[model samples]
Target: MIQKLKDKGINVIAIEGNHDRLFDFEDLSWLDHLKRENLLILLRPSVRDGKIFFDEWDGERGGMIKMGNLRFYGIGYQGVNNSEYVERLGELLDPSFENVVIVHSAIGGSSMGLMPGFSKIEEFIPLSKKCEYVAAGHAHEKKIYEIEGTKIFIPGAPEYWDLSENGEKGFFIYDTEDKTYTFIESKKRKKIERKIMLQNGSEGEFSAAFSMAVDENPVEKDSIYSITIEVPYGVFCNVNLAGVEQKLEELGALKGRVVTKWIGQDSNLPDSSDDLDIERQIISADPSLGNYAPEISKAIDKLKDLHRSGDTDQSSMVIDDLLDQIIGEDGI
Candidate 1:
């Protein structure tokens, strides 16, 4: 696909994230192909410890680089010098060329997973102040706007890495001659979420309501879904969540998670821990054991716990008792 773009006189420049080098950065045959396909992958040329983060990535680092007529002052993830790496980059940058800055760190504030911590946002402010335009990577969510008088841009991931994140995936196209940028949303497999409030509905009514909700916000073929229905405790035992998911699969969803939230406690069951016995906990922990008789389930629990905790001397006796309870001293 990239070669097709190159055939049409287009070029690509990109930054690498932690995910690119998570394992050991040793098996990077893909990087070589990217370089050959009219693509420029940027990185910090050297580290403070004089060690290479990636073995085959030979690209420009923290400095100025002019591609065609556009000039940029940039830094790679490996080239960051201090704890306040963003601030240090701002201080070192001349900002005289085109007044644009690029880096491998996150810029749109704190995010979960591979993105930088919240405090790093403060360090990022200095770079924002030093340049008129700043673009960054490492965030999985795309964001673009002015923060404290500086134009900030984050192009997220080109592809959806998590099927659970319900967001549009895409990249950015910056027109250096006009000093303008535009987002290009990619058409890829997406994940959609449907949350329904089961405030008032009978066991018979639930199936119809679920079907209507699905029809209103239809699931696309090859797309993933998570349909969550919040139901009252009284209706919990009657509703078949698994059946609902199977129905959604037949409609189009490639994968799905059908979940129900039970509100309030059922008054019929005992709520106090003190009222429960050892036999109850085993059944509660592993619900499959509930099908067996109480005495057998309790005996099985004792044997399993003893075996797990390495108390084998007593387990043998418990095993013998369990076998006798089952066999009734008969040969069969």
Candidate 2:
């Protein structure tokens, strides 16, 4: 894709995200390989003795890129944890050119689900006063926030990364001189979520509610869809979830999931039983969790069992493992 963009005389300047950093083989990453091939200008700042420093393009340090009169400074996933490095952003830019700072971090007024390794918007304050614009990632919601003279632009994920994510998927083109931005919607797949609340989990009740939901908001062709069925805990067995999802597949959806939400259930449910509401709630709380919700839900079940057994030590171990799994080995 970068090659295609380059072929048309368009330069793709990029910064490595948390996911991109994992694609490393030997010592060089896929991003490094692309930069070496001149397909994309990958900008990554250097950290020496806990201090951040940017190198010139000719030096191949990838901290800065100059296109015409605009200067773009990038601090990729590596800078997310270091407050000192991020605070020094203004000092790293040249005053002569129009400055733009880009980083892959959760930059907003508040903590985004209290997720690990995300810098808050306040950390960019010093740089915001000096830089003309700020482009941030790691938060999949599209928004713009201004601090001082700088306008922070988060274009959001180009595609729906989670069922919780809704609205238009797009990119932004900013006019550096005019301080204006024009959003261009990407030709991305749509994500549709529908809920069917059942008074009784009988097949008739399921059919009526499901058909009504489909009639009101007909599923789009080749779109990702999720139909959540809410039923009482005891009656969930009556609803054929597999058949429900299969009907969605037959209706021309690219991918479909039939998630169950058991309502009116006591917290003392058996451990052997599935508490799908926990998984749904986890994903709803932080959509970036994606498919990890199942594993997390299983861990929660284990913790619950341990608690019932009065094994505090075992419960602590299970919690530690869950935290490590979610936040990586590095506990924040």
Candidate 3:
């Protein structure tokens, strides 16, 4: 695909996503294989404000390169917002050359057409003054907003990585000569969603219903088809999930996830995490946590104690206790 993109004269400056551990190649020598082919030109900055850094940064992984008359500066993913960095953006940005800021973080702002699980609009407003456009990623929904005369364009991930990312899939084509960009929709893979209820049905009956739904959906040769089914516990227990998925494959489904929900068990049961609403309420009630809610959530998830709690050596402890018991019984 990189070669194809290059064939069409589309230069791609890629940054690692959250799923990618892009820091192993500090020397940048491993990328030589791709660089030799002239397929990709990475914008991995090594320094900012005269201080050298390792990986692509959040605020300033500063590097300037001219591509087709347009200068570009990139701040790759540091995996955190680091909102306060916006204040020093003016100092860090080089205004001498007209350039575009390529960041791989979601510049959260403007709730208009916001997708599920997306970062809300935040402190990237100051970036426009420093650069022509802030081309960002990480939000799996395409959203472009003109904030303070700067185009905050986030060309979301095309191939829906998660079920929530059921939005249209595409990438942006930046025409450097014209100083304009356009979204090109790629229809290689289509996403299909279905919600079905098969109340009081046998395994074969449920399978027939599922097969009917799949046939009715009309998924392409290689596409994603996700179905959410509401059924009784007995029906689910009898249903062959793998068999259904295999049937879907035979019908030309490339990949999919089947979500089952119990209806007759308890209709009033809470959805998702039961404590999520309570957690949000707590955050709303507390002014301090509310102000820095995002940060607090990140910190809470990073607690080492919570990570280590499940790592107890129960087998070793039991062996040691058994050894003590054997030592005492030897006298008998």
Candidate 4:
């Protein structure tokens, strides 16, 4: 894609993220290959004797690139919380032109609570004061924050890394003249979520509710889905969430997740501290795994029966298949 862009006479400038570095070797990075090939321009700053200096590349001097009235500055992953780096970068900024600082760092006040060890947006107050726009990366959610006259632009990830990352996944195109940025949404894979709450704990009730939810909607092909079933603790053992996932897969879902939530704890149940009985202890140990108690119990019963019959070959096959079915190819 970089080659294609280069062919079109378009300049591709990129900053390194944490994953782009080969940490084992000093001053080495995965992006070195691209830089060597001249497919793209690398503009990340370098530190020598505690002093920051930009790598001169593509006829551009310093860490600054000039195109018309806009100046682009790139900084890679250098622990944003590091006061030294942030302070030095502020010293490099030229307030004469429309400046855009593209840095891969977490930038937000409340984000510090959600992403510990990340630099607070306040840390970049100096840089934000000098630049017109601070384009940030590393976080997977799209957000914009204005500090003084500068705006922080986070375009978010181009694709959903997991079900939890639910939002418009894409990049941004900033208009230098207008001082406005427009989000360009990517044609990434869609994520769908379906949740069901059950009042009755019976197997019949569970199956009927699941079937109705599935039948009511036409599952999109090649789309990811999350199916959440909330049931009373007593009835959780009787319901089969795995079956619901299987049905969704059969209906052309690229992938499916079946999350079983056991609600309303039973007073008669054993305490989680009781390790004497493995089956009972498992249910009491973690509420998240409690929904699997019935399936685990059934599997255990079948294995015991096979053990008594001395069917070693059949037992091995059953165990292997069961493990594969439950764990999947990726092992959870």
Span of ten consecutive residues with least summed lDDT in model 2: 108-117
TM-score, cand. 4: 0.70
Q: Highest TM-score: which candidate?
A: 2
Summarize candidate 4's per-residue lDDT along 164-258 as a digit string, tens digits. Answer: 46666688988776877789987777777887788775678777876777787667899887877776555644666677778788999888778
lDDT of 3: 0.56
Task: Return whichever of 2 and 4 wins on lDDT.
Answer: 2
Model 4: per-residue Cα lDDT at residue 67: 78
Which sequence of candidate numbers ranks them by TM-score, best first? 2, 4, 3, 1
lDDT of each: 0.56, 0.69, 0.56, 0.67
Each candidate structure's count of clashing pairs: 0, 0, 4, 0
Q: Look at candidate 3 and give me any clashing residue pairs.
A: 108-120, 108-121, 108-122, 109-121
lDDT-better candidate, 1 vs 4 = 4
Q: Please write out the lDDT profile of model 3 over residues 1-332, one tens digit for every residue.
A: 89898989877665444444335655344343575566666556564576533342233222446655466665555443334333345456665666677766665422222221124454566665667677777666677877667777876676665653555558787765577888887664667888778776467667777768867887667877777777753354456667766766777889866766554423233445232333433455575346444433333332321122221222344345444554554532
How do all models score by TM-score? 0.59, 0.72, 0.64, 0.70
- Write out the backbone clash pairs for model 4: none
Candidate 2 accuracy as lDDT: 0.69
